[model samples]
Target: MTTTERTAASYFLPSDEPLGLVFPDGAAADAPALPMPADDVLLRLYRGMVSGRRFDTQATALTKQGRLAVYPSARGQEACEIGAILALRPQDWLFPTYRDSMAVVARGVDPVEVLTLLRGDWHCGYDPYGANVAPQCTPLATNTLHAVGFAHAARAKGEDTVSLALLGDGATSEGDTHEALNFAAVWKAPVVFLVQNNGYAISVPLSKQTAAPSLAYKGVGYGMPSMLVDGNDAAVVHAAVEQAVARAAAGEGPTLIEAVTYRIESHTNADDATRYRERAEVEEWLERDPIARLKRYLTDHGLLTEQVQQEIDARAEDEASALRERMNVDTVLDPAELFEHVYAEPTAALRDQASELAAELEERA
Candidate 1:
């Protein structure tokens, strides 16, 4: 084949329709070789999703009780939250956004520690180095660059590592997203970018965010392969992310996945989603709930017994109860620690400011 033909054949295009293994009604799609994971793996994904949603509910309650400063709930996006992380191996890195606390917990980070940032206690609750997960990024799309850089470094060291960076639809408009995609494509970095298109970026709808047909279409501009998946379908998202990860592990560069999901709740406790969208719209997305859909599919296939359901629900409740109790306790924090990791070496001006802040706290005490 000619060089041009070879290049043309290499480019993997985004799906004409979002790839989905199950319908919104929870019926598994008709297929010969379905991309569904093994039954045990499916049960694990289902359990993670159930726990994630449980955590989301508890965190939202904390926000109302004024324990957490703020929380971006991934209520309706449980499939995306759990499934994507399930695709990763122990060594693969995860770079999550502020809205992806559920995904962080699904990655095995402590549920309480996962809320550390929202608790107004520390920058990050869990140690990033302890696992391959990075701090939950609040800035739009910046973590994509970090993921790309880390993937490049891993490749440089001749290690088989892949990084998955999660972001919202609104972040795709940011320059950092563009830079990360371009850089990853050029360098063949082992990374996967999962854009959770939850219909809105805070109050801004996707209609106002970008003119592209779908965020996955942006991959074409960067010469990167892309896939579009039903983010609410755990099996579909898990299968697609696994495919992308396997491709990246083979040194084939990055893949952009746009998971079409919805944000059932308001952007945050502070923002009113009613200002920009209608209640009917929210009601519609709630019917397509990821957790319920998976539960139905598993039950139909006889994979989910009543005993299994009760066991998963019990475990989830335990986590929520623990989160509620822990959040109720007061946290003692040291203001001086804010300057601890601000720089490799504390600058003279930074030290002076830190000292002044310390003295001010001491005087107040």
Candidate 2:
């Protein structure tokens, strides 16, 4: 048999459904199983969700106003975005996709910095080392390899660090995703892969993307533990990710997490979601909205009184306004900056290009 044939045959067996933690009806089958976080922690998680929603809405508006080039909003999947990051410690690193600005913000990155790439300013808006969060990745599944390498290097240096990589469901179809998982498992790299399985990957739906039972099961083939969580449930998403982060820290290697969520908005301001997905389907998902579900849970627990709710709303509004104000200002561009960060020592070819740009700018000035 050919090497390719042998490799293909290894995944012939049927894999079990991933271990799920929460149900859509606001009940958790595993909350009792894992350590419950304090009420304050839960409240903070809720605030993050609210903040994510506000950020998405504000960014989307910016795109319409011509301030932002494009935006892939995670309006419905805020729980997964915020929940995963909230689970990470200060020293841990985060690899986020373009749609995951919420996760980037949760990591303490400035909202304007998070949108830097979309604003067409630089490769990544924020300094990765400063916040321990990678620049939001525009390419699919590419950050997976980076996350694995970071975790492996940290482990090699005996530093207690783990990386959580956030990617969309469509990223699973990329070869880099498979390679990263295989390398992570074999090398015992402390990284977590959070697949925000938000129904569709741009115009393509999940059903057409893969025949596997679930994206989480993809980890089983790589010899890693897999988890499934109600992505709309902030608490469960946090719990599952916290557990995965804890496991990775203890040297249990990588984990694959599938957060079942939906993208409430179109893929971006440019795409027409109405072309492929039914409005009915979107409305159905809205019924299980992450923000609403968490708000209900908090309200029922008396953690979200009317006064507290009012304060949260006010904070979200202020943040949205601040983001709008910061983004509305025109950014001063130095055309030569494009060639600056590409290399440690600029090559002759790049040097020539930079000089040309400098001359052009001087001419314009």
Tell me model 2's lDDT, rounded to 2 decimals.
Answer: 0.85
Mark the regions of model 2 whose C-alpha exceeds 4 Å error after superposition: 1-33, 363-365
RMSD (Å) of each candidate, 1 decimal: 1.7, 4.5
Q: Per-residue CA lDDT of candidate 1, range 1-365, in tens?
A: 34674378345567677888888777887432237788898999999998888999999999999999999988999999899999999999999999999998888888889898998888888999887889999999999999999999999999999999999999998999999999999998999999999999887889998888888999988888888888999998999899899989998889999999999988889998889999999888888988889888889999999998999999999989988998899988888888888789999999999989989999999
lDDT of 1 at 144: 99
Best by lDDT: 1
List the pairs of residues colliding in candidate 1.
none
lDDT of 2 at 159: 97
After superposition, which runs of candidate 1 have C-alpha atoms over 4 Å from their true positions?
1-6, 30-34
